[model samples]
Target: MKPQRIFITGGASGLGYSLALICAKGGWRVCIADRDIERGEAVLGSLQKIQPQTIFMPCDVTQFDDLNAAATKLQEIWGGVDVVVNNAGVAQVGSISDTPLSDWQWIMDINLMGVVRGCKVFTPLFQQQGHGHFINVASMAGLLDVPNMSAYNASKAAVVSLSETLQNELKPHNIAVTVVCPSFFRTNLGQGMRSTITGMQSKLDKLMAGSKLNAADIARQIMRALDKKKSHVLPHRQGRIAWYAKRWLPRTWYQRLIHSQKK
Candidate 1:
């Protein structure tokens, strides 16, 4: 039997790279798609040592043409992809009022529309194959409101919403959609993260450094969730707490808790 094939956007580094490692270890044919050709090729070389079936494709998820070409390439090489991980995203740290319009568009284009384009391109292929999974990497900010991350929050929230809708719509077709909502973990996203808030970059760096979970651990959790066919994967303990609190706690209480965190 052929190994299951998995394609990941932003697979050169961070969580996407970790996911690629995990899937390759499981004997899957992993295809990494990223805008950074150099890093993507480097990652492909590393993965080849573990699983020779791995390949790298230069992809910019923000561009539909890029994603379409990737899909076509996958079809030619592997017949079709068994899974597509829409994991390319950028982080923004600023209040909505402080965020520039260009920044908003940039974040949304890569974070939200990136996921949309992946799904739009792959859904048809999945339908033709009669089975597939979409792992969309959202964030805890999508589940709960956080200060100084309005743009990131909005983009992730849109992803969560889109994932939920796709989960329901694709159920009968045997395609699964899982939205991962993880809190801060060690990743390179911080390197390029845009922040208008004073000292926010350093603060974010500290938070990520302090976090116990790493990208590999999160990738394992995502694989577990995918095996169970879960719709949502919250890898962080704090993220789970916040998710439940937002759903079960009163609005006033949740507001108070959020306000207290700002202090």
Candidate 2:
């Protein structure tokens, strides 16, 4: 599709940055969007070393106006996008009782509303073009809940639901939507999560340190999904197994596991 003009949110760092790098190497015209202008430009600089056509635009997925402006600007620059990757997100780790209302709202706005806004703002343009692909980044937590991560779990579950709904809704319009469920990746995700409670910080710190996969590995799987036009992408083997088990087993068993370490 004319080398696929691609726009990616959260493209300044982590999996987003890695995806940007790989796509540029593959000769796709890429525009990366993130809230941090400096980091976004820095990633753009690095990407240009690989593919001189890449560029960066400052954007906050949580802000609807910012998302609209980003879409408008990128559309004007590229003429129209063949792909949109809604990868921007924030994670919050806390039990439902411990998580404040404000924390839940914030996580929902970034993780769930961000994808909604992305589709709302960009889908029309894709419709005008008659074909486009969307890749929404959800977490493995979307498929299964974990202890001390009620807010994150809720947000990602919403993302998965929204993605599935849009996949069916947008099918008639010739738009393909894929939901990405990634397991523990050594991205700045743990470090970058927003937490209202201070006590959970140290625990999250330990979790990040123990992550097995890195951003590059996750990026590769995301690209595979994009190229293959797969509806659901699982970045890690454990993530796949986890989803399978959750699907086959009863909710009580999963709930028991979440409530305690015993399986």
Candidate 3:
């Protein structure tokens, strides 16, 4: 049997890197796509050692033509892709009023529309092949509607919504969609974060460093969910508990619970 072919955006570092490494080790033909050419090639070196056919693609998800061309190129090379991980995203923290309109558009373009473009470009390819899987990386902020990160939350929330829509819309077509909503873990996400808070970046770094589940742990959980064809995945226990609480708890009570974190 031929190895499964997988394409991952933002695959140079963080969860994307972990996912690519895992898939490559499992004998998949991996395409590591990111805008950072230096980092992408660095990761390419490692992946090539594991799976020589692994290729690095310089992809900026915000560009529709880039994504479309990537889909086209991969189709020609591999014949068909088994999975597309729309894992490229960024973090931003600020009150809605404090955040500039430009910042909102920036995050949404990369985080939300990036995933949309991936799906749009690949859905037809998947349909033609009769099988494909999409792994969309979201965040717990999207599910819980956390405070102080309006744009980031909204973008991820939109991804969750779109993933759900695709889950049902593509069910009969033999394509599977899984949205991963994970709380913070150790990652370089803070490095590119946009924030108005004076020390929020350092705080984010600290918060992520404190988490027990790192990117590799989350990546493994995602792979497991994909193998099982789960529609929704919350990789952390606390995230799952909070999601259930928000769903079952009363509105005022949940609001209090949400507020209690900072209080």
Each model's backbone clash number? 0, 1, 0
In order, candidate lDDTs are 0.92, 0.85, 0.92
| Candidate 1 lDDT | 0.92
| Residue-level lDDT tens digits of model 1 in 120-207 | 9999999999999999999998999987788899999999999999999999999999999999988998878888888878888888
Model 3, 126-168: lDDT tens per residue? Answer: 9999999999998998899788899999999999999999999
Identify the runs in model 2 with alpha carbons over 4 angstroms from their true place.
196-202, 259-263
- Report the alpha-carbon TM-score of model 2 versus the true structure: 0.92
**Candidate 1 segments whose C-alpha is farther than 4 A from its true place:** 1-3
Please state the error at residue 202 of candidate 3 in Å. Answer: 1.6
Which residue pairs collide, candidate 2? Answer: 94-148
lDDT of 1 at 198: 89
Encode model 2's per-residue lDDT on 177-242: one tens digit a residue.
999998776676765776656766666666556667778887887777877878998877877876
